[model samples]
Target: MEDSIRRFFARYEQFFLRALAGEPDPAEVAGLYAEEFIAASPAGVKAGKNDASLIEAMRQGHAQYRAIGTRDMRVRGLRLSPIDEMHCVAHVAWRATYLRADLPETVIDFEVHYLMQQRQDGPRVFGWISGDETAVLRRHGVL
Candidate 1:
C-alpha cells in the first residue's frame, strides 16, 4: 500500500509538470482527477465536473502561473492514511518556484489534503482541501 501511494504521487508529479506548462495537454491533466470531484478552499466548497469548463479553468490557471513567472512546481513530501480498502487520504507538501527578470527566484511552500479513490485504473483524486492560496501568492508577489 505504501509503495502504491508513492507510485501514485510520482505519477501525479509528472502529470502536474505536464499539465501546468505554458502549452498544457488538457486531456492528460484531466486524467489526474475523477470525472466528478469536489474542491474545498478558503473561498468555499464547490462541486465540479471534468468538462470543457474545467479544462478552460485549468488553462487559465496555468496562464496565471505563467504570468507570475512560475517555472516549476514540486511535491516536497507526502503522508498517506488509508480510510478503507478502496479509499485513502493524502497530506501533501508542495513548493512552487518563480523567476523574475530583475529579482532572485522565489519559492513558496504550501500543503494540501486529498481524498482519493483507489480504482482498478489507478488512484483518482475525488476531492481536495486547500488553504488561502490567494493570500499566499499575493504576499509572495506572485499573484
Candidate 2:
C-alpha cells in the first residue's frame, strides 16, 4: 500500500515540475489532479470542479508568470500521516532555481504540508497549509 502511494506521488511530482517549467502540455498537469482539485498558495486559491477548469487555471498561472523558468526542481521528501482511511497528509519540501528574462537566477526553497486524498478516479490535492525559507540564488547575480 505504501509503495503504491509513493509511486503515485512520485509521478505526480514529475508532472508538477514539468508544468511549473512551462511545458504547456495540459495532460501533464491534468493527469495528477482529480475531478475536484483544489490548490492553495500564498497569493490565492483555485478549485477545479472538473479537469477543464484545472487545466485552464494551470495554463493561466504559467502564462501570468511565464517569464520565470523552474530549474533544479526536486521533491525533498514525503511522509504520509494518517488523516483517515481515505485521506492522508504528506509533509513535503522542494526547491527550484528560477530564471526570468528581467531578473537573474534566484533559488527558492519551499516546504508544504500537503493533505492528500486518494479517490477512485485519482488524487484530490489540497491542504497546502504553509511554505517557508525562500532565498535568492545570490551566486547567479541578479541583473
Candidate 3:
C-alpha cells in the first residue's frame, strides 16, 4: 500500500514538471482528478466535475502559469495516510519557482492536501485543500 501511494504521487509530481515544460498533452491535468471533486482554499470551497469544461479551464490555467513566468512546481515532500482500503489522504509540500526578466527569480513554498480514491484502474484525486496561493504569490511579487 505504501509503495502504491508513493508511486501514485511520484507520477503526480512529474505532471507538475510537465506543466512548466508545456507537455503532458495538457488534458492530462484533468485526468489527475476524479469525475467529481471538491476544492477548498482561502477563496472559497467549490465542487468541480472532470469534464470538457474543466479540461478547457485547466488548459487556460497552464497558460496563466506560463504567463507568470513559472519555472517549476516541484514537490518537496509528501506524506500519505490510508483512510481505508479504497481511500487515502496525501499532504504534499511544494516549492514553486518563478522567473521573469523584469523581476528577480522567486521561490515560494506551499502545501496542498489531497483526498484520493483507489480502484481497479488507479488512484484519483477526489478533493483537495490548498493554502493562500494568491497571497503567497503577491508576497513574493509574482502577482
For each of the candidates, the C-alpha root-mean-square deviation to the true structure, in angstroms, is 1.5, 4.1, 1.4
lDDT of 1: 0.84
Clashes of 2: 0
| TM-score against truth, every candidate | 0.91, 0.69, 0.92
| Candidate 1 C-alpha error for residue 50, in Å | 1.3
Question: In model 3, what lDDT does residue 96 have?
Answer: 83
Highest TM-score: give the candidate number: 3
Q: What value does the lDDT take at residue 69 in candidate 3?
A: 90
Ranking by lDDT: 1, 3, 2
Q: Which ten residues in a row have the lowest lDDT in candidate 2?
A: 131-140
Tens-place lDDT per residue, model 2, 30-92, is 556555655576656756565677679778866654444555467777788877877887777
Residue 50 Cα positional deviation in candidate 2, in Å, after optimal superposition: 2.7
What is the lDDT for 134 in model 1?
A: 90
> What's the lDDT for all of these models?
0.84, 0.63, 0.84
